[model samples]
Target chain A: MEFPKHLKYSREHEWVKVEGNVAQVGITDYAQSELGDVVYVELPEVGTDVEANNTFGVVESVKAVSDLFAPVTGSIAEVNPQLEEEPELVNSDPYEDGWMIKIEMNDPSELNDLLDVDEYKTFVEEESK
Target chain B: MAEPGDALRRTSLYETHVAAGAKMVPFAGFEMPVQYTGVIEEHHAVRQAAGLFDVSHMGEFEARGPGAAAFLRRLVTNDVSRLEVGRVMYCTMCREDGGIIDDLTVYRLADERYMAVVNASNIGKDWAWMAARKGAGVEFRDVSSETGLLALQGPRAEAVLAGLLPGGGDLGAIPYYGAQERTWQGKRVLVSRTGYTGEDGFELYCGAPDAPALWEALMARGGGEGLKPCGLGARDTLRTEMKFALYGNDIDEATNPLEAGLGWVVKFQAGEFIGREALLGIKERGLSRKLVGFEMVDRGIPRHGAPILAGGRNAGVVTSGTMSPTLGKAIGIGYVPLTHAAEGCEIAVEIRDKARAARVVETPFYRREKA
Candidate 1:
């Protein structure tokens, strides 16, 4: 439920840390806790083109498999390689070491559509209730 | 939506499970614990050492009267007449077409007294089936709600149970598939030297009120050896390691016992019984498809209902699969063409629109150390 003030979040619980045209993407802490004990993470290859609000990868837990949707339109610049051996990083450090991809933003204006920390916190609280 | 009457159906250890921070889920019409601590941790504990399981949700029925043996022989697939006064035998309740109703264990307590321990989900259906077919001199009674069952299983289970009881004698004399009545804490309890996990263990049955005391006693005595309270999650994984057939997943009314690799339990030579004719006919002919075990060679885990492929063609579907805690690899069971059921036969499972390489391996995937 910790929504850092520096990052922007999507309705699907993904977070993006913006820096110029380059942005780092990963699921939020709330997403990892809800999923519980991530066993496998399927990440898209670097340089792959991703559309906003489209599924780009998969995350599997012991109970079920879930689709990871792209929060913004971008071209993947880098993929986290450490997840191949340790998927639990998504649960332990979702915002830092567990970042899924680094993307070159196709349209920086799309950032306006994402929610801020306070708004994202309210969204999750209302959804849970 | 939750119903008001749901609270009425609770196991004897319901309060204890909730107190231990267990995740409660509705299973077989009762509130049951699905996990405690976590599924993976509890599963590994049972595989390496001892684990206690509250199986009180399982149904127990009694068949008593002068003709109890004859009556059970007609209902179940195994030969009940061969069981002695204090022994147990595994059997299957088959339909008229040789399809399985449920797999159960029959314990012959006396000349005219017998106990049938069945799956929790099949309690109502099985009870009605037996009651409708009550023949002359046979009587049936449902004693499920009053019985409390606990299973203490793994490599060090015998030592823990023996230490809890008085005299602390060696239980090594109890052979596999054996049962005897014993006293624990001045209370009469039936202890069975059997378990779903392929381990040296005992399953204890006592009155509902005595279950809490027995569980506490065993936990206290087994504290040092990594003995933990396991939930349904661990129980499922433990059974799958031994290639044990679960009723709803592996066999059902649509699948016959012959096709499910349970033909050995059907005693066709013994006199007439329900589903006997169909099973005999199946034996004379041959099965078109048979259940086989497979291990994934790729990274993906195969799951139930996933399509199986052989030689790049759709061959069958997986009935059960999991990332085996003991094997440290993905394993599954599926029904494939009879010709392709041999050991080491290559196959593939379609997981998430991708075909993962797999190989048909010999079961069981795991075996416990002999005592």
Candidate 2:
């Protein structure tokens, strides 16, 4: 599973790429791989307020439906509309085109609590073992 | 997420699944393959070409003796006498209260021999139920462990099978829901022109020892046509698109066939049966709830057990749902008040905290190519 060195990941398998006050969030490659062939994505509506670690959306794969938790507290700025048509992007390019939502980080400091790429990799490997 | 010593049972082809990079999951007490290659790809392959499925986890029971037909006729809802030798019929086993015991396919091998293929999880329960109703001269044998079953399904399934077996070109004329004894790789096999997926396909039943070889042989022959080893994930989605009733999810002991929309299979005129009286009364009293299909209008998926609502009141729960690989839309099957069972009835399904708008639609979200 690819965990980009620049991004931050949550225990729930969501990843965040923060740029100043705006942050782009999506599920990790590890998450998409485990979920398998995502069929539907429920993204938080734009301008919706979301709390860190709280469920803001859901991802439905062929096998099961899973909650997509917010990695950091923020007001949703934009949600990926493309996911409504092609949820498999979460499986194909989870970190880039599959980005679920943009959020105006309410407490950017919360990003520190998220795992870095190296730490996230170790965490996933240990979990798998 | 391996659980140590979970004791999940293994099918004869369990090792083969693992070798194919299958994602194994605990299902009905067996370590079964949930996916191989992927769900969507396998699902598409089954729609366009042939896909092989290792369905050995399904249970098979043999009922033989002079009274076999009479015994099964009373046990299941279908009119077993209607089946000729070498034919199969789908039926539902109902409790005395008219609730579903399990959905099964009955295969008549001869005048005095029959085979009932049941869901794996309901084997013990169904066995006990059949034993209690067993009368003199009928013998029931639990052959689930010794038998291996595989499904070869798709538009080109017959072509693929004919390419592998000598004189197999006639398999295309077997007719849907027909079964016959055949020889494959020196083993006597039972090839049935029946399947759970809504596709023209054949189900092969053979000894457990021959399952791996058969699967490998078919896969090798079908490789040129984009045939993939499908797992239960694709199988579930494929069957769901056809609105096929699954045992635990769609019909359970707590729900009767009448409410599950299987009343047509219950032959009340065929004389007395185990649940005949209750089911006949249900037919007279009218159904209060009925299983219906629905499509999500708003964003979100309606998962199994998700509450279904009509005018903000609880109407039912989703029994099965998926983004149909064929339809490219979220579709599900659920039970609702009989008043709301008509096609085009607007409804909503609660997914998480949001209620997604949906409309009751006609069943069989997908259709197979005509034979």
Candidate 3:
């Protein structure tokens, strides 16, 4: 379970890495581990507008189907092309190559409401119990 | 995630499963492991090497009497009278109206002694149905609670079972769907060359108390050879890949044999059975809808209850479906109108309100080559 100190995480088990007005989004390490061996990933188009806390995509493991929620209000800037051919990257390297999308934020201040490295770790611990 | 709750029954190997880091889930009224390691990994192990499955939650009923063969013949859709000693027969026990009660396998231990293994969840219902139709000369006993079953499946299953035998006994004598009794570790055990997975495998029926030790022994002997302890998740995917009909999902009380692609099991000439007459009627009237295997032409995963569409109208429903771990493609089994049930027919499965392109295909999507 690796959580980079600079990224923000959502209660829905997604992580956000913000740079300027763009934010890269991917599921957290805890999230990918819980969902064993991802078989398929469904994401929105690059220009699609996604609201915060709303479902923007679906990730299907062999035994379950999980919804991916947007951590902040944004429009899709980019989507990972590698995931189409290699969905298992979500299980192997969830933080880096497995990133789902990049969003151009509508309200960058929304990042304040998200959890930091320490806060997200604590939140995950409570959720697991 | 829903908790299994304290009321769910536990199998004898419960402690061992927890120790092995299995993800436990509620299944068939028991706290059963849904997976260990992962479903795909465990699935490939079963197809490539060997996999051990603790199917002790399945039910077993013993019938012994002067009329045991005749009684069982009348109880199921298959011809039980032709089941010689040491052989096994697969069939469905249906009601008089031809609704399936349960699908089970009958093992003929002797000329007048047999065992019917049923689905774990249907034990009570199946038992009552049989007992109500019990005759004066037939005696039925529910031995489900006292029996533990383990399926050793894959290419290396033969070597694994032969290693555990008392004195290096070869399994060549036990043909497919054949059973042999042996005193294993001083306990009476029946080793049957039968399995639901599309692999050459064997099932071991032993005392319930002996499950944990037996599981440990097989794991220790076969683990080094790539035999992993699999769970219900792997069991499901393996059977689904073979297109084996599940009792609740594919064939239920409302589904009959002829339309479910099990007409061969319903042998009217094999003598009297509960649903023989109704099945004959169904055959005469012709099938309106039939079960067919399909492959997704699009990227969506078709699931059970997904509405099937064909010729721009509602056709039928998906009975069983999944992303095939071996085929690397999404495969599903569902009922479609007879006009759209052919091997090359074009159909669409509506997944999450959007129709996805799919085409009917031949069944048993993945068959293991004889090794």
* Candidate 3 clashing pairs, residues 3+ apart or interchain: none
Count backbone overlaps in model 2.
0
- Measured by lDDT, the strongest candidate is 3
Runs with alpha carbons beyond 4 Å of true place in candidate 1: A1-5, A28-36, A109-129, B1-8
lDDT of 1 by residue, B99-130 (tens): 89999999998889999999998998899888
On DockQ, the candidate that comes out on top is 2
Query: Each model's DockQ?
Result: 0.39, 0.86, 0.74
**Location of the lowest summed lDDT over 10 successive residues in candidate 3 chain A:** A59-68
Model with the higher DockQ, candidate 1 or 2? 2
Name the lDDT value of residue B339 in candidate 2: 81
Docking class of 3: medium
Looking only at chain B, model 1 earns a TM-score of 0.96
Write down the lDDT of every candidate, Cα atoms only. Answer: 0.86, 0.90, 0.91
Q: B200, model 3: CA deviation in Å?
A: 0.5
Estimate, for each residue in B161-280, the C-alpha lDDT of model 3 and write its tens digit: 778887765678899999988777887879899998999999999999998988998998897788999998889899999999998899998899888998878889978899888888
Q: Regarding TM-score, does 2 or 3 come out ahead?
A: 3
